[model samples]
Target chain A: MPGPKIGRRGALAAGLALPFIRPAIAQTAEPYVMGSLFPMSGPSAEFGEAFTRGAQVALQHIAADNLLRRPVRLQSEDSQALPQPSVVGMNKLISVDRAHWVLVSWTATSKAVAPIGDRAKTIMVNGGAVGPDLAGLSPYFWNVIALAHLEVQVMVPFLVRQRNARRVALIYVDDPLGDGILGQLRGTLPRHGGELVGSFSVPRAAQQFGPVVARVRQTRPDAVYVASFGAQNAQIVKALRDNGVTQTICSYSAFGIDSLRTMPEAEGALFTSQKLDLTGAHALTSRFATDFRARFGQPPLVYHANYYNAAYLFGLLAKQVETAGGTVNGDSLRAAMLATRKFDLVGGEGEFDEQGNMLTQMQVNEIRGQQFVAIG
Target chain B: MTAFLLNLATLAAISGILASTLNFIVGYAGIFSVAHAVFFGLGAYGGAQVALLLVPDPFLACFVAALIAGGLSLCLALPALRVRGEYFVAASLGLQMVAATLFAELKPLTGGIGGLVGIPRPEIFGTVVPVLPLALAALALILFLTARLQRGAFGRTLQSIRDADSAAEALGKNVNAAKTLAVAFACAGAGVAGALYALHLSFINVESFTLDQSIQIMAMVIIGGTGTLWGPLVGAIMLLSLPAVLSFIPFIPPTEVGAVQQIIYGLAMTLLMIFRPAGLVGDQTKGRSTS
Candidate 1:
């Protein structure tokens, strides 16, 4: 944490040796290598695996189709979803691994890794970190997921229209992920003629939710919305029922699906998802879902959709750019990323805004029996 | 080669400070302070705030932030000191969770999950120092602190407290006061490191300082050697920098490579504990300094 100290003697000695050690470095013509870092062994390992699987698929597709014209390879690093490991992982990715592009996941790791990416001048793409302010921080960084700040704007309208909710209660983890969503809800909910009646805040990865559930039950709102992760959300749902709060509880994406597999109380929870229901045979959805199932040997989770789309988009962009006779260096690749006007993928057409937020529609679903059924 | 050295040096610098801080709590004071990340987070937030809000004199803000962090650590220590061992570890972990959540949710102050961005690097005495120099400066601070702590009577007293708090307390030493001071100093040092980390990366969030970080800090101290200065430096360089270096092997995919590295690290730690309980630079035995 302290700035690197320069001892008087050591500084002088280093100052003297600097002239001798100095040599203007020239750029080498090595093929571009990208590093994708994620939490592959810890709690976040599920998402990390999915992201890597997507990246791997994308890289394969690129190679199969000759997307970049000049063979580009990808190296994935596991930060174990922790800052120190991520920092360590990224250092290897850049200095040792020699990667040009670095992709990371989730808000926590992204926040830790972004600075490292910027310091190293590595082109960093965030597949999972969706905090709104992330885009404005560093030029080299961009996120594939929608910002948490936009959740209210994106979800409030849906909540008002689809769920027919008059009053809403908010239960969120007390961190940046929760804060961004809360900010969005505060800003957009009132505009949509809905009121956030009461709110509860819990710590991240909280195992016990009895007190938090008690706080939410006291609110007695018509609908309760929890912006939490899988395990925490599952615990909260159980607590909510135990407290006799019969309100329709909804959670933010993937929590419901991941929870039902672990916590049975998550049977009928409603949640928002960026991925559409591909259960039934539809052209784009069916192909992706079927392929994903074959590859991973299970139905694609919510985030898998984004990964699939991101990979496809990457291959598509690389091909188009290479076809245009542009090198897939940082500037050219960034231009290609920017040039993506409308990417018609599996679920919908994605139009990346100037901020690189892929403006696309999401689906709302409720767990009916054993599957996520599309609601309206 | 220079880049590799710089990377290794940077990891060592961070690890040294972290290990030193951990040593004060777990090594010297015999406390399982899990909330080490809180001080680290505070430093990061404080440093970033100082860099952004009180521009033109960010270094001044670093001290201010450290003071605030130290004060907060004292507040946390007052209640946490009541607990012992694993329970104490759990409590500290709870504190870390609570702090991180607050940092994320308290959007007005901490910038939420999107985190604070564009934190300006320090401009000490009107010179724009690059990251590597700043890294070297951090390493120097660690070295200085390590050496200073070794020579001082306060250091010996602290170690005595860790060695046997009951005996130390019986000898007319204020055990609680010593423990609290150790925690505070460790937190302050971690805070300073956090500030430097902010400057180096120019971005931060609550996610950066989680319970996992507390564990990592513990690992740095454990793997390096609790009381020695160079232990953390060695561990950090080896563990943190090794993965980065391995990422360059073209045949290994970065993701696969990362997993392999973790497996290797986990095995290394296990072997070190089983065969050499003293750790790389630790005292002769584990749990000897503290009971």
Candidate 2:
């Protein structure tokens, strides 16, 4: 009777202890730290903040789900929106903090850091660097943001075939960033049977713009494509209106909308974005927006959606690697992350091509009254 | 290969030429017009504008732009140059700020904030002379001319004004003319450099030519040694190379390194002023009278 009783008690103890063992092993799992180099304090400070918020919300969502096999941490440093600062920030993130993966901010910063990242054997994901010069150039780099030139391919066809645009004028920011966009327009517009009537590049920090306004107005273009950002864009739009050059205008990114938010005169400007509209009919986006708003006290931008997706993708890759009996080496994680397809992450169907660029389509938007409305 | 060397030489030459002219005004003439960048910017815009509006040839544009810059410099000099010492400095700085603001706000004309870009490079006959060869030739010409000017009567008169403006005035020498000419020369050099910069980078934006750039150019003169013909070269090299060197070090973030490098530069300048006030090749007597 005593032998049977002792056997039964031992069996019960073994059953209870089995569930605790895996988590104990999992608890000891090594955390993989993701490093971010962004322009937190410089020219693109607002965009940087939006990116941080996006990445943060995503990471928080993954942690809440206990979807990560190991602890995940994100550390960030300011790049000041220049090449040298980016190189330094990337070094500290990799050498000091031992980050295996890096997400760099902006096209210029990414272009600057590509050589450094290649030398270090670390994977770099570019958030906003959208120049075609970077594409297919480096194997180590992955551009998550759709490049500006690619938009010309998408936008020109749509405008020529769909909107019946013929004569177009381009107003660019007169830098490397604008140069890339200009190259695209030059190549694509002619092929699309649309004529580029005039092109103008402006300098930054210029206090007045009467003469350029006069020149742009002289062209009398049917459509004006503006490639600029921040207060400079605001000033240009204001100058365009003040100088009486009123034509249908389109901008590349949320810059025009961001400009309109501050400048009442720029209320009807149109732009494009990668983030799903919170006000859209998509159930997932609506649900995410509700949750995000409740947590952060505002609607989420596309940058936040990207961050959530990156975090989710990172965790999923880590889990897959752990299951495959492979260690979370930089190369291994990068390969696994790249191989991801039809991944129903937080931002919708996630995909990455051979160039490490995200394949998600962008949405067109126009600012009406005080809000951004989906155009298509 | 020759083309590359020429372009490199041209950039150094232009910087040197600009530096030499600035040396006369700041080092020898003892007028630290912080608005020197504005003059430089004016030359760039003027050069590009003249080339775009009047002449298609970059070389001819260079001349027209220089004349425009020189003419503008005189206009700026009349009211601003009358003040002595700190007041002059304040007035010049104000001009720089106002000019930069005008360039941005007056968008209809200046392309507000997006600087003039794609201004054609200097061409010989039908051949588009490569930047390197053109720059090298330009550098040689600027250097030769600067060397000649330094040994000329104008140079001596400019030095006299720098040594003692009152004395120079008492000697019946036109002090204002000397100062204005020195400014015009500096403005011309800056214009040439700006035109080349527009061509070389194949881009020009307002961000590249800021009040901060004016400050940097001034630092080049001060750090390299005031009034010395070679001062700007050494200073430009130091300022440019220091950041380049700091960029190579790992473990330190570039931004942090940049901040630290600036701090060290400030300390170095302070020490330079304290111990070797004459700078690397500065004459103590000249320093007292001029600097």
Candidate 3:
């Protein structure tokens, strides 16, 4: 049977529709994989829920808001908050799940996984782990959060100018993040005419701070900086108060853990963090809080917001790449990110340097009655 | 998929090597020492330092690691001479704890908690070797040597000492020397495994070689059947690959994966102990320890 011949007008209409149909098919390609490597099983498992929910919420937004031309899925592995496990998780994320872009947190885990990410040529976006060592860990690596170096740059001068504290004694955890902060304070303090009187490294298992407290007292500094995190901050601070060695205690945003902030020991302690107003007011943050609470039945924490920004940023970057005749992978997305350095994150507007480190306005805050209050 | 499988294989082989060497001590010599991870960490630091400061030759790294770990084995060997059975176990545990602390504090050489990161991939004659092959070859060599040693006279002497310590000594068996030699050789083998572990992971930290790691190696030896040659290999493969397999299951929630994996692994171990007390691959008649 002979097919009916199309008229000239019909033939012209079909030809014009070809371009639209081809692009529509292309836009429906297989969903890309976004991966998260976090401590989901070990001591730091508490961070896992927020990290996972944050990314999932962002993916939900990407779909609801039509943020990307194609769909994307999230795959995750447990890092156990250690380097060795992180290597294994990172391998599975890259090789098995085919995650070309990975989100990493936890300072040591981030550092450990970077080599694998580099080897696989995956774009690794770090939303947590503010270690200065991660600043340029790999060409494929970039930070969605400010490194501790930036916090130190904004903080030490504030301490010197506001409190007139010149000699700063450091009590830091014996880990990469703490080491990075210490390195920054070493250079940052000196640059501002301040001296690092003594720096004591504390292992993760340390409990009795009597020796550390005595050593810090011996340094006779005007201010003490606690570069440690979590419950240890409270212990060190309590020991300092108990010893009657009260100077303006300083730290970074890692001090925001709920346990540390609520304690009487952390009273009057100051910390520098990326400019984020915790109030549920800002447009993006408010929307995110609503979405998070709706989905996860709780308000988001600081880390959740950071990871949400990471996931949303990925979708936006992928969209931009697709619009510009590229696919979402290490090279393509990285070039797109470098080109578009200024992104409107869920918290606020964030800027990135050539090294792909997202820079934010700095805010100094104090723990006042279990709340983080901006200290001007 | 290929890279992931290769990584898994490399890890499994490293664990297998550790299990086999541990079997040589715990199974063959009846040395119930729990400080095997100390040797692993010593070797890891040794190999990592060499890779970071010098060339990343796998052979050179292995050799240096063996010497470093073997030299340190005197701590355990001397204690083994004075202690018997459970006393030696306690001494070995103390060593593991002390070694872990040292590994974390030796910042100049070990890089402290951050560890020797970015350890270049191992190379032989300026050629970058694939990690799985290197690990697999190492595993094969350890297994072969173990089989050969088991049939030799030295194996019989150790067997006699394990089954009847005082009688073997009265028979002019040079008991102390045999124990010392067994501990050193077993530790050296563990050091070799550590070298390959560092090479495979391309990073090493104090966390990787902890008391938990020693317990894991012990479990592999016990679950796989200590006296049998392929026992450790079976146990290592089971433990190392369980999580990977569980991850593939569609019904399990992503957040519940690790917890579920632990339950399954524990359940498997319990079931194995109940069903096959000698081990999955062990001969019940010969694998028992009278010492």
Candidate 4:
């Protein structure tokens, strides 16, 4: 220990030689800046935090897989899921941060920023907003998840033909998500031989559904379909049951919300969700499930899976761009995406259409004794 | 960064016009209506319809929007302004709620919650005027007009009615007529502001005209100082810029910025009321009763 001790002059010499000894330290590639505009505060902050968590885990897997030699840096802007903050935050993300590729959520935020992103030629990958209008928003804008029309289109036949629920009542939220469902139903139900007997719309912020429930009950629908999200879906079900409506109530993936296992009102409800069949010998989804569970001590939700897939796709695309002797940017990445329209994701495999929109398989499932038992 | 600042400045300008008009009604006219955003909504929808259906002429759109909002102001003014202060506030609140519902439900006009999009930029003389410059010019015009209105006989009549309606009425001032006219004029300014807002954002929706938005506009007037020409403008700039300014501080954590902003706004509002009741830029020499 005494022999190893260095004086100030020796220490200075060693410090001076360090950079030359490890020259590659100075040659590391610059980090790729990935921008994520989300509701980092306000009512939707939980979803934002969860999306960030998925991305964090994705970085670990991206490194383990050696998808890209260069590191990726995630930059976030709090949109608060509103127009004003969304516009300002989007401009900051594009102009100041210089993140050519951004992940955006919320229907309003997507619509507000679509024209701006298109003007700047920024690649905005939306995985959360389900608005149908987002389908044809911009050439630069792409959707990684199924839009509302697809979900509702797939859901209607399952309710009508499979369940024999011809006369259906709808309780929908009055925002984009609900409007998306509403727009689709206008065409979908009549085509599927199902009639919409009663349709009730509650504001996005409506907490009390007594008047709505009373109206819906009066219609005496054979089944009730709730085009809603979060706690509202469960609240609507509870309101229907409390008002003595014995209708076969159902919804999309929202029926399997986190609190559904504990809520008796959500029992017997069927939903449509995308699930990867991890039955192969070395399935990527099975491995991801194991690793995600080991890391977070909980199974990943659909949102977590979606965000993880979004980040994982970026890594794959970056590798493709670099391999093709092009810089990884919005245009190059978008080109890579279009060239390879199909992707194998941890959630499931998907194929992007000519419109840069992807649709996942929606498997029907039912809740039996708080367990989500798949039907098909 | 410059573009970001420009975005914020455009927002501030739109908010400046809104706050200035609210200041006229609440501060000068002695009407504490909380439904100022309804007029703003009316103007926004009116202007949006005009620009989308007719031409993108900034002047024509704003003028039509202002006239529409001014006429509708009578609905709130005749019923609410003649009542007590608290009842006027309640009436304004109800108006905001009803207007929000109407904006959302009137699918043919307001786009049914998805909002009206693809609105072109302000075109003047067949040349497109940039949104930032247009917004700032509108704010200047509103402030100048407010100054002239607050200083002349119009201002005296409002002040006299505000100080004591009976005394003003005894002196042959038409209290109801003056109050109604003041509301219409103030609402017209709000309409112009709303038109600029629609043009600036290039999108309009019911969310922008909710009770929450009304409260924010009211807060701008109260925090800046009521009854003063520059008070609401200053408040608009300060409140709109608070989040950006806080991000520059080295000690504050990024996650705590929003919370810290709310805390600062609440504290500033409380301290201003207790120590400087007139507001940061409120007029103190007007002999206006504070209590």
Candidate 5:
């Protein structure tokens, strides 16, 4: 005899019953494992430390209320700001730890980890990496922060409209992140009635920007757009100022408190960044900032907010999956995340496009005294 | 666990090939070339482009990459052969910087800072071999070929030239030709490794192949005991596997793991240098200074 009448009727019955059964099974405290790869001990160690603290704070927040039915566990690795280490970390996370979700920061590390995430069918949330290459790169990868080009798009218009910058000079670190910003500025400045007079790339470790500063000075552009970050940003700004080329200086979010502290001369510099005012408005932001300060004993960097947003997003996705009576695996969570139209994160009300790029507003901030005061 | 092991094994295999290639130059031909990774980058970029734009076949792409790397190494060997010792090293270092600049500037071919991604995985005879096993097979083949070369007359000529190039020239040996051939062969090995690495990672950038990588390869040869057949393999295994093993230790915070691993690695290398200057497997009588 044939199969015992297990046709459409039985299949439909099983399909209908699966949803009811799944939630009960999922509610049984199945451990949700998250693996994070950060540059915890390399050139970008400061940012990595901030990212770790963000993850910790996010986890603590989740654990407080038991946000999901399952207990969440985080297994992290230090990527050392290098591709090889990031790859190794990704492999261990995917193959050994069996992490359901992976978080990565930094352009190089994210680029290195994206292919692995695609192959392993795991969802990778890029918290801080904003390289232009990440746009439409992978369905498995989601960039929580705005793409570099998008940030430049926002910054350049502000420069043209508010700053009234016509001729621009570009100075960037010779790396993917810097290159991405420069590429965007070149394409964007022309459309905004601005001309790129001079463009120069300094080596990543070059402390002496004398020649570069001299070259930029010769051009006498309306404003100088710099793409260097951290200590490099301070160094470049100081070099430019010391050379007496006092054209209105502007940069990407790279001009942070660290850079400002190092080069007090950069007090009047203008830059565009994701609105990171912790005490300004959003309750979540205020709570996160307060808790972070209490725990880490220092103000959270903008990168910390990015990672904190990632962890929060992960929880939101897991909650959505649970509510929909679905298994909390990579595929399901990714689908849930993509389907989400908006999320109230610490940064702001953020939305993601189909390409997993977060669409958020960037505030133009001016360094006033020792703090970054939002101008626009 | 299996995937982690496979990844570690693949990394070791790639490192082993690089170490072996460096050994051919520094151990056999006595050329202090620090531009080895430049050739490796060329192979990776060339193979990646070939597979991406020219041919879909990974093996053919790898072969083309090897040929390109070998040819490029031969060209470098012509000028490099004029110098010796530390001077040669400086020349190689300069060459490396130039190659890096080219890799960064030639955005059309190399993809510049964005790098070439979406490289197709290796497929053989309608079957896709797992990258780990393919890497291991490549390692085995390279080791076998290296061993065979060491046993032959070519290897003897290389040793003589390494020891005393002027003396070898006086004895009617075509010293220039031998140096060029040695560089070509060694670079081919690096090319194969690079190709395999590109295929395995399915992504490559200028950052992966740098002076740092060349230095790391040289360190592997030194630590494993150069001039011996098994030395590079041992060194590659040790260097590649140590970090993975250390990562498993409990109580160390994840944030501090990388720094701790680096400290341990540095300490191990320092102690080895202090205790065994000739290296773990190198002959004490044939010290580095003697050559």
Candidate 6:
């Protein structure tokens, strides 16, 4: 009886020491390193800020739920939305930080850094870039956002069918994103029985849309397809209305409801958006939206959802690798990701195709007086 | 860390070549030409095209690109040289704008806004030249050539022209020809740098060759010590490496790193200007003359 009593006392003492011992064991496991490259400053800071915050929130949730086999650490670099700086940032992330995964945010940066990723044999996830060229570029490259071509593919039919647009004039910003959308529209519009009347390319930072609007008006098209985004999109819309050109204005998802609020003329304009309105989303998406707003003090942009989905996918893949008795690495993680048939994300349930492009539904929303109402 | 350092070194070498070219115009020749980035773009687009279409050899492509850039510089020099001082600066700025527009509009050649992608990596003797060693070699070659030029009569002529163009012309120096040669040589260096840059990054766009880039290069030259041969290299290294170093600091969040880096860079430049107007390695005696 005395021996049994002493054993029970020893067991109690061991249990008392378990809290201190558990962390020590946990500390021994190597952490997963994720390098995030964002346009944290410069023209695209809004998107970059959203991406960083979304990823942070995702990481927090993963940690809270103990979703990963090992602790995960994220290190971020600023790309500044330029190619040269982007390359430098990528190099630092891969070589200096020895990151296992890199999340890139822009098309030019993703393209510029692709060679590096291929050479380093590191997994790169693109949460924001949607260049058409990115499809099938590298085995290690994964795109979480819908491709720009896909958005245009969805838009052209909407213009012809839903909006009854016949002759469409194109006014797009002169950049890779704008150019990709224009190319897609040119090829798809004729098939839809829509005539391409006139097109004008303006600089990304062009403030003077008077000349561009004048040229667009000369065509006298039934609808003007604007492939601009951000503040420039607002400027173009204002210029179009000011010039008395009242053709139905359709745009790529360049301006959100907030951006359009500043330009009252943008009301009733049709645009394609990858982001769902959180108020009417699935329960999971609504919860994510609520959590994001609480954390960031603002509603999440589409880019935020993309990055959050990426982080969650990464966590699941890492857990799968661990469960299979395999180390989490580029190769194993890639295999795990490829094997996954579907993912439930903040945007919606989707899957990655063979080319690593995400297959997700985009919403065709119409701006109705300071709000984007989903039409089709 | 090694690979990152190599990347940084490669960028620094490319930047050194560009800043040195600027130094030749602003420091030695006192032209203050802002069209250097235009010539740089010419070299990149032209050289990449040649490598992709004509020659598989990157070295030959780079040489041809430099020659093409040098030839193009004469076009700018002809009209720009007709003016003097501030007028010359204005003329170069106009040329810069024209070149930028051409880069954006020449869709067939430059790939327009989509930019030229999938640029083949440079190879030599059936082996791809690792970007790091190639970049270091390029730096060595550029430094050697710059040093040779500085020691030769061309350097003295440029210096004399910078001091007093009238006196140089009076002494039988063809001021116009000297200026033209100087611009051509400087632009060739910029072109060579651009070729390497395009190859290393494997992509190029009009955005990379904007007026802002030209101003950044000029800042490097001024910060490094314009007249000295090694000053541009030092400045290039400092400016290019500053961000990487700041990125390692733990206190600054990644979101705010860029803004903080810019502030630190600006503060450093201001302090350096106040303390060492002649530059870190510039000879006080050979400092920029007001005249």
- Show the lowest summed lDDT stretch of 10 residues, model 4 chain B: B246-255
The candidate 1 chain B region of ten consecutive residues with least summed lDDT is: B245-254
For this target, which candidate reaches the highest lDDT against the unseen true structure? Answer: 3
Report DockQ per prediction, comma-separated: 0.26, 0.03, 0.28, 0.19, 0.28, 0.30
Instruction: State the lDDT of candidate 1 residue by residue for B1-291, as single tens digits.
Output: 456566566656765676677776776667877778788788888878887887724466557657877878875678545766778877777788788778767777777765776677778787766555655665677578757875797777777876776788788888787777777877887887777777766667676677777787788777777777777666666566545544433454444655665676678678777766777777775644463
TM-score of 1: 0.81
TM-score (0 to 1) of chain B for each candidate: 0.88, 0.82, 0.95, 0.91, 0.94, 0.93
Candidate rank order under DockQ: 6, 5, 3, 1, 4, 2
Model 4 Cα shift for residue B229 (angstroms): 1.7
lDDT of prediction 2:
0.66
- For candidate 6, the chain B TM-score comes to 0.93
CAPRI band of model 4?
Answer: incorrect
- What local lDDT score does residue B239 receive in model 1, on the 0 to 100 scale? 60
lDDT of 6 at B118: 82
Task: Report the candidate with higher lDDT, 2 versus 3.
Answer: 3
Model 1 off-target regions past 4 Å?
Answer: A1-32, A115-123, A148-163, A183-194, A256-263, A275-286, B1-5, B24-35, B56-62, B65-109, B112-114, B125-127, B145-149, B152-187, B242-261, B283-291
Structure candidate 5, residue pairs in collision: none
- Candidate 5 DockQ vs. native: 0.28
**TM-scores vs. true structure, each candidate:** 0.81, 0.59, 0.89, 0.88, 0.91, 0.91
Local distance difference test scores for all models: 0.69, 0.66, 0.83, 0.78, 0.81, 0.81
lDDT of 6 by residue, A174-272 (tens): 877778878888899999998889889898668889988998999989899887765687789989999999999987655553567446898878877
Docking class of 3: acceptable
- Residues A1-376, candidate 1: write the lDDT tens digits: 8998889899868645543331222134355566777777666666677777766655655676665656655666777666656766676667765676777776656767676676666667776666555665466676666666654566677778877875888888776567667777777778988888888887666778778777776776878888776356677788888778788887666453444644556666777766576765546567677767777687766666676666566667667767898765556666887876677666666777775567677666777766777684
Candidate No. with top DockQ:
6
Ranking by lDDT: 3, 5, 6, 4, 1, 2
Candidate 1: chain B TM-score equals: 0.88
Docking band of candidate 2: incorrect
Predicted candidate 3 versus true structure: per-residue lDDT over B55-142, tens digit per residue:
9999999999999999999988999888889888999999999989998888898888878878889999899998788778878888
**Best-first order by TM-score:** 5, 6, 3, 4, 1, 2
